[model samples]
Target: MNFREFAAKNVHRNVKAYFAYFLSSSISAALLFSFTMIILHPNLGAIDLPEYLIKALNITTVIAYLFLFFFVFYSVSVFLKSRYKEFGILYIIGASKKQIQRMISIENMIISSVSALLGIIAGLVFSKILLAVSGKLLGFNALEFYLPVKAMLITFIAFVIIGIVISIFCSFIIKEDMVLKLLKGTKKPKTEPKTSTILAITCVVLLTTGYYLSVTSSTKTLAGRIIPVTLMVIVATYLLFSQLTIFIIKLLKRNRTLYMKKTSVLWISNLLYRIKDNTRMFFLITITSTVALASIGSVYAYWRDKEAQIDRSFPQAFFFSDIYDNSSMVDEKVNFIEGSLKNEGIKYTKVNDEMKFIIPKGEKDQVVIIKEDTYKKLSSILYLNAANLSENETILAMPLTKHGRKNVVLENIELEVASKLDKGIIPAFYEEVYVVKDEAYEKIKGVKVYFNTINVKDYKNTLNISNNYYNNFPQDNVNKYYNNLLKSGILRATKVAYGVILFSAIFIGLIFFVTTGSFLYNKCYMDIIEDKKKYNQLNKIGLTFKEIKKILNIEIGVLFLFPYIIAVIHYIFAISALKYAFELNIAVPSLQVIFIVLIAQIIYFIIIRKNYLLEIKKSLL
Candidate 1:
């Protein structure tokens, strides 16, 4: 056969070994191609999208390109490593080093060319769906799909160049001097896997410390500690797989009763070497899966809880406030809003209150002062408890702040804190508010501000009314008003932005997860030669196929499952930090993400196990 024909036949003969690598490369190409198509779409610019949306898409596209490069490089290296023995055989049969490199180049080019073509076709098939989803998330009209010649050309060229470059780099990974080691492959191992006591203990300490900081740190401190905590956890997880796991397995082996059990001896003996060989792979998978889960869970939680956040920040449907001197203008705006609401047949309740700004004796910040009667009327509308303040006592109203009774000297008047309200009755524009007795309010000297807060029966449906008021009397330094409709519009925009984030995160996360599984799969098949020889020997000694299956199940299960379990543990601590940082209860969404990933992992494990068993079985026959 000619040289190029030999290379092509080699790829075709070892297609099983190349399957995962091919699949990963194709999917990566498709992901990049789809993203490019969206970015280059003619309709993307016509839609009224957020300014950062296109920037975000561009950034994500760049990230995807980088990811594709790394993934291709890594997969190629692993695939070549698994074929070192084959290369050694070819070398003994008179294949020159340069000839081998040429063969590898040809094989890689074939795979890359075919993968790129298939990926482009897949991208074309899914482009419409991608655009539809993007349109929905961006809150724009459906983006029309065009024949993206530029995208197709770019993705195809980029993928092919990356593949060729990676293949050339990978060809040197098998050295001429390492022919003996390559020939031996997995058969040369004689030393027992060793664990470092100090590193194992350090792993425990680091993980505990990281988890502690992640769960205990407050929002104020979380930002500063995030990097340190992440580094600790990552280092600890590496040690966990490389040192701690081996240490535990060694300890388990000492228990004669458990170790002597049927198939336990078989699987455990195999597991020690397998785990040692796969330590780095397991660590990589665990880290990748943890990042994916945390990203998708956090963004999903944020999108789900957005409306509740809006409710907390905006308690009133419509709020208008201005200096008492601007009562003429304020009156005109309020009349216009109320008239519009009435004409639209919207039922509402209006509460009027006057706030006086006073600088405390020892504080430069102004505190808003309102009468107890007005506080009660507004509280009644919000269904909050009305506070009863004595002549010299006042209630502090602040959201998410807890404090005990304290005294404040407002303009020479000493006021005792009677109580506190965790919920804000007034708009957030007023930082701190004090509710005092009417007689006491009259005694305080400060600038007087009059404001009205209205609650509509269906405040969510008042967007048009809110927009009308905003259009007529736009907010400025002089005209201070909180239109629920305007705020809702802003909230909608925020949701759209977050939705885009969630959308991108979901796709990226899925890609990471799929690639992670492919990595494990390729690693497993890389050992198939050794596993078949080992199991075939046992089969000669009266080990039934059933027993062999059981042993294989245990081995593959541990290899595939433990990393994900560790990843979930890491994700739990991660989202715990998120919960504390955002002060949002994201437990449900986080759990849902975990459950979904767990299911996907289980399914993947089942499929890999079946395929692995079949390979081993074929060797035995």
Candidate 2:
């Protein structure tokens, strides 16, 4: 047959196979298309974005495409594996390897093309919604909603090139012999279940060590060390996720009473057994869940802490700042600010914040790791960001108390240990921070700023006043900086919040869908097979499908609850540690996440149980 007829016949013969191919292709295409909109926007000139932002966009775009590419590759592998017998059949019918290769290539092209179109449309719509939603959340009026043609073009090209290369490689490697070998499915292969006591003990030890390093080890300014430690925890968490539950289940089964107790026991045992065979998928789901939760938590925590930053920086409704005292806009803005505050019946005093810069004798880039709560206190005084660290030198920046003096251990101009009175000043409450004078400030020449700090009648009204003051005067330097940040922040915060919610629904829902869905489906499939023979044998002894399904439902419920129970307990202790590290005094997400999980579980239960009931009712009738 010609390629066209070959393609047509293949599609007609295997719609299910083609559908799977298209579904995966569509997913990849959509990711690429959406990223295109983000990176290749036409209206970039409106905001004077830094080059690094563009670079970051490019990097994330590339990474997203890579993730999608890997995902597609995985789907293709599964599809080929499932259709091995079909490949063998083609060979059996005397199709040459070259002919088979061509057919596969054509099929790949058709699948990719259709999926690309679907993905592009979906990407445009998704990007537009994302832009709009981000706009609404961040309170920005300028809507950056559009389909990026450049991104579309880029994604299209990448998709085609990558698809062709991967397709060719897979085809070249899809030896006809393997398909023939599996034409008659082999019996379950003998393999060891990963349930040894030694493995369990090793998992515990590795995870505990990782957790210890993350929680207690200081990593303030030392980003280098933090990376390895974080990686360790990530690695340990995944390893334990793969091996823990199976071992626990196996250990429980050693007890005759516990093993034979109720439907719950049997159910848990069966689930642990089944999942043992699919540890890789289970590990993936756990990893996704962990990352999703961490990303969402990080964003919200930053937002929550932003209030303190606004409080510190913008104490009054009207304020202004200048570097090197060079800006003419400050006086104008300050005058304008005073006028507006008076109009609103608010009283405030402008405080002159002349800071002394101090440099201690030795090293630059002083690095130290501390719990985040302590970091916050030190950051407020020093003006540094808190991150994971892997160093010992504690760098603290604090405003010099005196007008001019040199009290530092080291004296050098370029390396003179001078002070920078700009951002990242170290606080006095923390011992790591030191105060110096103007001469020390002169050492650090890159940053020079005069800060006009003000205090207002109400804390609640502070943000509003800051907003209005910036809105009225766009030309002021302080306002300009704030506006730039506000614009970008709104875009980011909205994306982060929406991403959290979306992944929350999609990721959590997916696991529940798969884990519960397959369990229920298996129940029905097993019933059909067993009733034909095993059920007949049991029925003669008075066992019924009604009894079997009841046992199955109870089994499903207990097995399903196992993960959540463990998750909740882990979550509680985890949050407690978080609170200590971050100094959080308010409501925690442990309850919230748990509540969401419960709701998902209930919905899952209803859907799965309903199907199980239907199957039983149908059989009984």
Score every model by TM-score: 0.88, 0.64
Best by TM-score: 1
Error of 2 at 384 (Å): 24
Clashing pairs in 1: none
**For each candidate, what is the lDDT?**
0.81, 0.50
| lDDT of each residue in 1-621, candidate 1, tens digit only | 899898999999989988888887788778878877876777776655667876777777777677767777777788887888888888888878888888888888888888888889999998888889877766566788889899989988987898689777977787767788778764664679999999999999999999999987664688899999999999999999889989988888999899999888888878888888888889988998898899889888888888777666667887777777766665677688789888989888888768888888888778888888988898898899876777788888866433443998887889998777767778655757888889888988998987877787666687787777768765665322322234455567668788778877877887787778778888888888788888899899888889999988888899889999999999999899877665777889988999999998899899889989998889789
Residue range 93-149, candidate 2, lDDT tens digits: 887777777777777666776778888888776776755643443334435776477
lDDT of the structure predicted as candidate 1: 0.81
Q: What lDDT is reached at residue 427 by model 1?
A: 66
- Residue 414, model 1, lDDT: 93
Please state the error at residue 612 of candidate 2 in Å: 9.6
Task: For candidate 1, report its TM-score.
Answer: 0.88
